[model samples]
Target: MNRKLICYLLSSLLLLLNCNKVMSASWEITYPRTSSDSDKSTDYPLKVLALALEQTGVNFQLIPSEKHYTQGKNLSRLKDNREINVVWSMTDRQREKDLLPIRIPIYKGLIGWRLFLIREDMADRFKYIQKVDHLLKLSPIQGRDWPDTKILQANSFNVVTNINHSALGPMLSNAQGDFFPRSMLEIWDEIETLQTDNKLIIQDSLGLQYPAAMYFFVNNQNRPLAHLIRTGLEKAVANGKFDKLFNQTYQSYIDRTKLKKRKFYRLKNTFLPSETPLDRKELWFKPN
Candidate 1:
């Protein structure tokens, strides 16, 4: 072949290869690891998700999000820059907005958690929040500021928002706050190590349950890649790779005994009477 003809052929082949090359997909796992020593180990769960893709012969990259960008805006920026292709866990409206949910759920949240936490000494003062009007009568309950504020505000729950769970104990102990209502698991996790003095108690009497589901959120524009991830996860689950991953990454967290180390007492507030007299007018009042 002539030299010029050979050059033209090479260029065409290069263009074709570039066009056919599979785009690299990556993920940023947002949850924090247990500690600095365990940072690299945190990548294992995401690698499990990646291993599933590998089984399907799908070549992609898995990148764990830096612990510094744990949640909210910082995490959003990592996705905006295309630094990561997926967020490991996110909830409902979040899944609908910025990302697409593939068929397989990386994890499922507990159906719902509604536990009211109180200073151990003050459990008798405030009980489950039954009537919306009754809650309003009780002033200054303790709650976390972020989602709690929005959730409480929407439901018209009368409560004061505290930035951290740690603050609630001292505030309630000092009589500055009423019952601290929040997700059962959240408060339970916080009080696990701090329960040495019988300082805190979690009461699941409010009956306010929030269901949170975990999903892999891919950017909206990357729907095709999301489908690939779905296919990979489906195959993984069928082949038992998913179960192996769950055991390896999460068995410790799911242990009921370990999870229940701190007693989460279910205190029935005076409002919830176990036995109602047959003819009590208030108990039998029917909505007209």
Candidate 2:
């Protein structure tokens, strides 16, 4: 028996054993788990992904983060060994070395650098970001170890990568750094809560605009299965099921009474929770 041939055969067999014509064994969604009410893992994106997968005749076991997903012992395994097959809502470039990006985009958003805020008083020092080169020369800036940092570096912004976004708040509050760049949606609440007097502000600066955004990633080793999953997602979107899922997940976040503040698009389609919603009573720790 040829040793190289034997190894290839074993790898093929393992892939076959793990995934069937219908589905893969299970998937891991890498995200931060915290005490915040928004930390409910069973919410929107996961449900959208799972519903999309099921519609394509695929069945997946949703794996929740015991601790913060990105900061836990599990992420080390995911990074070093490529053990996690599928990760929901991951910025692509940072994990491309170890993880493969699905071609189909799960969501769309503008990816760019936003200025950190301590209070409204210091708004003078930090004005709008006009150029990437100008931002690089400033004091240390912080970001999570994801594609956001890569975008910053690509635009010539010197960034200090941290384990979590929460860590950057203290650094900025203590006057240690100039600003922290982060995804606007993910850190909106955290910034307002962490900054004293509830006076956190983000500068209007567009660093990068990624038109077709992704909300998840899969391990490079499972490239074949990942492609199939993406195809199912596209089908779901085309058939309107994905839109239903998106509305359901996004509705809880948007305040309906604040119609005057919302844009025309958001106001048009009021979101609704899934009909056959997964029992996430176990996942929610806070009172509704």
Report lDDT (Cα) of residue 112, candidate 1: 28
Off by over 4 Å in 1: 1-62, 82-84, 92-95, 103-105, 126-149, 159-188, 193-198, 204-207, 237-288
TM-scores of all predicted structures: 0.54, 0.61
RMSD of each: 11.9, 12.3
lDDT of 1 by residue, 96-210 (tens): 5555655344443321234555677756655544455665555445434344345455555566756554465667656676566654334445556443334767643443444
Find the 10 residues in a row with the least total lDDT in model 2.
Answer: 264-273
